[model samples]
Target: MKPINRRSNAPVFWGLFGAGGMLAALFGPVLVFITGIAVPLVLILPADAMSWPRMQAFAQHWAGKGLLFVVVALFMWHAMHRILHSLHDLGVHAGTALKFACYGLALLVTMTAAWILVAVGF
Candidate 1:
């Protein structure tokens, strides 16, 4: 049989998943420790570590915006890919429509994050 050739855009999603997983591995625990335990328990970081004004100021900074955007957007991409694959594994098999919905939601959230970050005023 002649090789049945198919082209897929999976690399893009896989790249996002890989990058996001790396980032999540690096930052997720730190975030949980800081926000979840440290801040709440007032153990290591100050309790106001995530206070509104301080967070607003951080969001207004260019570097902070970049970091926030990358974290939020990449995480969304990672989640969408995982959910899409899970649906496939479950035999949902909705094809392009499902792909559009998954990635579209991630894109929508990413854009919303960018807009909110910009609105925070640099």
Candidate 2:
């Protein structure tokens, strides 16, 4: 019987993590740009008439929601990893406690985001 090699998992995990981080970094700025430019511009436009359709179109676009989800998930994942590692370094090696805290934070953020997304129709 051949022994299984668990080391192979490391590369795959790091690859996915790196790729996801890169995508998050790349899109983050674009998301910021849209929020800073498009959103404010839309809000500033006179709402008397002729701008209703544009506003509706903007609302219907999924770019904002998509960007938000990507940014948030990535940020959470990165933060959770870094924070747990830092705690471990600081001699807090209670794995169960750390896991519970991280899970709680992630769940809270996910629920809040879902509520907002649903409310915004996105």
Q: lDDT of each model, Cα atoms only? A: 0.90, 0.61
Best by TM-score: 1
What are the per-residue Cα lDDT tens digits for candidate 2 across 1-122? 77886555445334534655787678768666565665666665344323566545544468756655556755665566557667889998846777678756855676776566557663
- Flag regions of model 2 displaced more than 4 Å: 1-20, 27-60
Displacement of residue 14 (Cα, Å) in model 1 is 1.4
- Candidate 1's C-alpha lDDT? 0.90
Tens digits of lDDT, candidate 1, 2-104: 7768886779889999998889889889888987899889997887888999999889889999999999999899888889989889999857889899999
**Model 1, residue 3: what's the lDDT?**
75
Residue 52 shift from truth in candidate 1, angstroms: 1.2
**Regions of candidate 1 where Cα sits further than 4 Å from its true position:** 1-3
Q: What are the models' TM-scores?
A: 0.90, 0.55
How far off is residue 113 in model 1, in Å?
0.6
